[model samples]
Target: MGRGGVPRPTGRGVGVLAAGVLVVLVGWLLQAPALVFAGTTLVVLIVAVTISLLFRTADVRVTRRFTPDRGVAGWSAVETVAVLPRGGRTSGTVRVREQLPFGRLSDAEAAAVLLVPGRASSAVFRHHDLPRGRHRIGPLHVDLVESYGVARRRVVASGVAEFVVVPEVVEVGLGRESRALGDGSRRQREHSLAGGEDDPVTREYRRGDPMRRVHWKATARHGELMVRQEEQHGLPSARVVIAVAAEGWPDARPTLPPTSRVGVRAATAAIPLVSDAFEWAVSFAATVAVEVGHAGSATVLTTPGGTLVARHDPDSTTMFLDDLADLRLDDAPGAPAPAPSPREPVVAVVSGLGRPDLDLLVASRAPGSSAVAVVVTAALPLGAGLTSRPTRPADGRARADDRVLAPDEVAGALRDSGWRVVETDSSVDVGRLITTSGVLDD
Candidate 1:
């Protein structure tokens, strides 16, 4: 039974009640006692059925739990719904429906399960092919139906859970180009400094020199004191700049306000092109961050809001992706404008770039620091699949005012401005795109 509501009669029950009245009228006209008695009995049966339906006790609750609440794209996750019925009264069937984040209710009959009254039951469903973002699941909908389907009580149990799907990471060797990024050389320096492999450098001994460090051969040859000196290792730090500024996008909605930070929510009806570009930027940023971390370099991330210092550890990487998952393009009218990026070697990820200042932002932050720019565009063929090396247009000229610029044009422009560049789209295999670009290597 449902609280604070009256039970309505089923269609069949209503028909039967009407037929009983008609039968009673016919009996009265014909002066027949048998028909009247039959009609009265039929009417009484209808009332009894209605009363049974109204009094039936059904206190059922449903809770949904998802296995591996967070996962990468393409992984399958299982959802288990536990049905608990109280009062030891189970005379009905429960049809369950879990809500999808996109405002669609899951299919009903497939999720339905019979209630065994006081005993609890569970049903399982699998979610697959989820995209990279934060998805909310749960708030199970249970429909209590009588054995004959004459009445139904709708129960909405509220317990919402969140599932975070992160970008997929594909393993690959960072080739010679990656070695040039200073990680390999840094390791060699570390080895030499530790004196585990390389011979210690010897020099004239000072008064404070340790006797163990004394070079007997040098001392005997020069007839003077000599001591071994350890070399210092200098590890190069890497900085990654990801351009998430909505205004920087060629197809960005001009009417939309500038966002104060990266995680600000966008409108539900954001333009499809803008949305696609945003996703590409985020995924590309995550992939690059991971690569830098794996390279044993200290990494810093610069986005539209500000800069975030990233690390190599699993927890740090997870948190970094979590921030990316929550990244959105908001309209901030009253917020202060974002500050210009400081000079640093940057792996700039943007939807588009044509401004000179934007070019300078991607150039070296200081001498000896290298920069790479990755342009994520939505103008590529949607279903043809991702391509890292986009071909130049026949004309080889790009309109500055176009809604989206060609990747080659962007690359050429950035190159002319003194930065290494790569072009890719959202659908491109992330691992291959960044690894083969030779950006991480520099």
Candidate 2:
């Protein structure tokens, strides 16, 4: 390795150099003119090839460009690598190998390229079926090969790029069914505040404040600009609770019998049930958070470790999603935290209604608080080929057979406790499920 680049001798180049030395020694001992000439010519050719490859990769530059710098799960992103040689003309083939996201680059097409000086040579890496997480596509390895493929030089690209694979989000509307029962009473108070001129709430004028809201008497009394603060009336307030406890998640086991391969038993494969369930639950939580933001509700996102106040803005949404991107299932459930304000509706995403989870939901529920529990059970071993078809029990009854299905049991418990429950599997459309459940609509 040198300051410019690392030079590695190819198999053919090493063989040629060894043969040239052996032939030269033999010719010197035998005093043969023709053999000496042949030996010297071979050595010169090898030296020339090494020298050419050494400098070709020294000044080479590589830049990567991602078609939509960010991607989502199950979506395709294209990465284009641009190769340029700074000074001299590149004599041989330039291989641009890229580091791909989510192990998405299994094909050999990401490396095939020829470098043209003064003109950029580009190679495309198509990343498909990306998972929801942060992926780094960077530190390109560029290999410069001689025309005869004898000598090579390696150069690592300077920059490393990052791509965020966010969870899929669907816009959900807050339906009346999703609203808290206290919402009506709160609105009644807001209306009273709006009609009463003597209401005490007042604030300094803001940029978007209407002139009509300016109180001349208050302004004169305060000796500065003042405006009567209007009551909060944009949308019904809602809170989102996300529970990613490992305790509530079911362990994945092999669903099928082991088969023999070459007369030997193969290891049983298990579906990533717990991982899948957690991912689905996170995505569902993110969708609900977005809906709450859109409704202009006071958003409260509760995780196992802590709570985050999410506002209706791009930065807040990005920050929340970024947290979800790195979120994982905790080994044990955290201690009980402060619950959301009882005056607004609440949406909770739990693996299932285990004792702790049920207690938390019950504690958060007020007498008139409208609450929705989204139970994510796609990973549970309920049955074969389960779909997301929500069923209502007759006379608020739970079937005896549903005891095995923990999600169903949780749903029944919630329903009987006077809370709306939405059951979801991996195949369910989160956005559609929320909207169809009438949680986001009036």
Candidate 3:
């Protein structure tokens, strides 16, 4: 269990010992000196080998490195383990086994056998279909076997190491109007000419300021020269809200398509126990956030739990993906949703729309704000089995009878409240939907 090795006899060693005992017993009955000597020699050899192996230690250092450091879900990552012996003398044949999380990798890929290790031996393997989450890799188990395979010693070679698997971000295209909204030129001119006193896009006038550039309204209110700061209006601001509560998603367990690399075991660990609809929602939300960020917009990501990512910088985007990696249904069941930023574009990703969800979307529609709701129409594709009963709230707040609103009803309600709504199912490609649906257009 610790650094010290535990030596034990192999199956061949046990068989030899049993045979030696039987030979000795027969020799005693026959009163033969040569037979007794041979039996005694065999017994002595087995005992000596065991004792030698018990005293000998395989002093080696084992370290593991991951390619790209962080993996992406549904992708492949390479793991390389290097074993270096400390002393000049060669060690016995070594067998290295790395313990992976969730049994995602096969034994043959995770295990390696090396010949006598005089210098160093390294094993490199690729793990496919990486699950999203923080997973621990090691505390390597090393086995040292003698040349004859009579005795073996087992020891823990390395301590545990952890790596993160972030959610996948896909390319999403915005409509022409949506792209124009993100452009800084028109917004810069609007803010420069009509910015109020508290506007961040305007700043105190600097030396040699052009009179035409001065914001007279802000100047009059502040009793000082104020000029429009065109640089501050470079990037637009946007918000993305995703419904994470279990009650908002349907209750159905659908089998993954045959081509999916994620099996049941990996899925159970990587994804929350919620339905496929919820998983699709998370992926789509992540894709929207990244796409908005790429469009020169500072996007904030929020869940019912609260604000998960406040900024759309590279670091914040990474943090947002990390948060989505292990997002669970019961994480923030009854928590209040964060209010959307006023006058900013908002995108809400939801499934099995409920009363609370509708209220949140309706309230997010500010006078100048644009709100879009992407609703998953079906929990999963047709032919994928689904349960007839509704999903009860995991927090036990809602009864089974309080089923979610139908997708058409939810879309109609939002449209009445002056919001654009996009209806999709789990089977549709999120990127394609965003590109062709024209939901982001003005």
Candidate 4:
């Protein structure tokens, strides 16, 4: 655990000791003085080496650095480790091996050789396709070997460090209306051009108002001096709701892969055992939130439990991504649905919609607001044929025993309630849909 631990003999040292004992015994039995002298010399040498290494003090420090500081899932990251001598120089070659967390690095790749430790030695390696969530790395294991290679001492050079991998954000092309979707400048221009006397973007003229800034039509309508607001731009707001309840993703629930170290880390990090459909929903939601934030919209991200990211600013997108990396699923059913943001656009990414979920979507529709729902069809519950038997004849009528609605039925219900519903499976590319399907277009 510390630098002061005693040195132990290597296999070579053990062999030499055994040979020396055997030689001494043979010399005694045969009455040979030369053999006895050689055997004694070997024993003394082994003891001397062991004693030297046991008391030897070396000040070695280990430090690790990550290239970008922040790691993203599905991206490559470089880990650099440096071993520097503090005051004293190493007497012989030192074998340095980093104690990486369970799947961070292979045994061969985690080790490095410091030939002559009179100067600092460093090792740099790249890890590809970093998994999402948190990981622990390090506690450098330094093995000090003497010139004879008969004895070695192991010491802990560094403590463990934490590495966090945030969720990946895909760039989604919002098509021709991308600029108009969340751009404050475009919204301001359109509002100013089509606004009436009661336009919220205009105000009564104050003292020292420029004549060019005066709104003549508004002034005549109000019978008072009216002026256009200076640089007034209303940035659009959006709400992204992601369903996390286990009950919402019944059909798509899959057992975590037994051999996945990332899955284990995710569970230890408090991330839930999510279904494939839920993962797709989360990724889609994350991508949309980041893209919307890039477009200068204040986006709020919520789950069935509560709000995750309250406000999306320039830096909040990263915060939201990190939060998504640790997002967990709720076990209880009937968790309260997030309240609608009156007139703001709302996008709900969900799977297996029930009647309550459908009702919430319908109630979220306001006079001027747009509601969009991305339903993961792969996770939706099956019709009566799978879950229950129909009590009535096969006349395409509603069956009394039908408890869960099918994917198409859920989409139809939401569409009837004034929602723009997009039905997709987990394998579909959301970015492709945004570009070719015009899912975000007005």
Best by TM-score: 3
Write candidate 2's Cα lDDT for 1-442 as tens digits: 1134667668888999999988988998999988898999999988887886655543566777877777776678888888776756453466766655345343255476766678777888888876777766766766777778788876777767778877778765553234433354355457657774554567887653445456677888889878767543233456677766554555423222212233224433321223666667777877876766554344556653444423332226776676566655553344444455545677777755445456666677655667778877764455643222222244766554332226677788778988778777766777778767765542
Residue lDDT tens for model 1, 237-282: 4556656545445344322223212343554344322355665666
Models sorted by lDDT, best on top: 3, 4, 2, 1
User: Using Cα atoms with residue i matched to residue i, what is each candidate's TM-score against the true structure?
Assistant: 0.63, 0.63, 0.70, 0.64
User: All models: lDDT?
Assistant: 0.59, 0.63, 0.67, 0.65
Global lDDT of model 1: 0.59
Clash pairs detected, candidate 3:
none
**Ten contiguous residues with the weakest lDDT in model 3:** 251-260
Compared with the true structure, what per-residue lDDT tens digits does model 3 show for residues 1-442? 3374667778998898889988998899999988888898988998888778766666677778999798987789988888887765646567777767645344344465563556668878677877667877876777767678887777776567888887777766562236624653355456547643345457898653445456777788899988766643344667777776665566533333222467779866555454567767777777877766555555666663453533453225766677677676656454443455457777887765566656765776556887888878554555643232354665867566666676667778888888788878877887788777754554
Q: Using TM-score as the measure, what is the rank order of every candidate, best first?
A: 3, 4, 1, 2
**Which of 1 and 4 is ahead in TM-score?**
4
Clashing pairs in 4: none
Clashing pairs in 2: 173-440, 174-440, 174-441, 175-439, 175-440, 175-441, 176-441, 180-370
Q: Which residue pairs in candidate 1 collide?
A: 177-441, 178-441, 343-365, 344-365
Better of 3 and 4 by lDDT: 3
Weakest ten-residue segment in model 4 by summed lDDT: 384-393
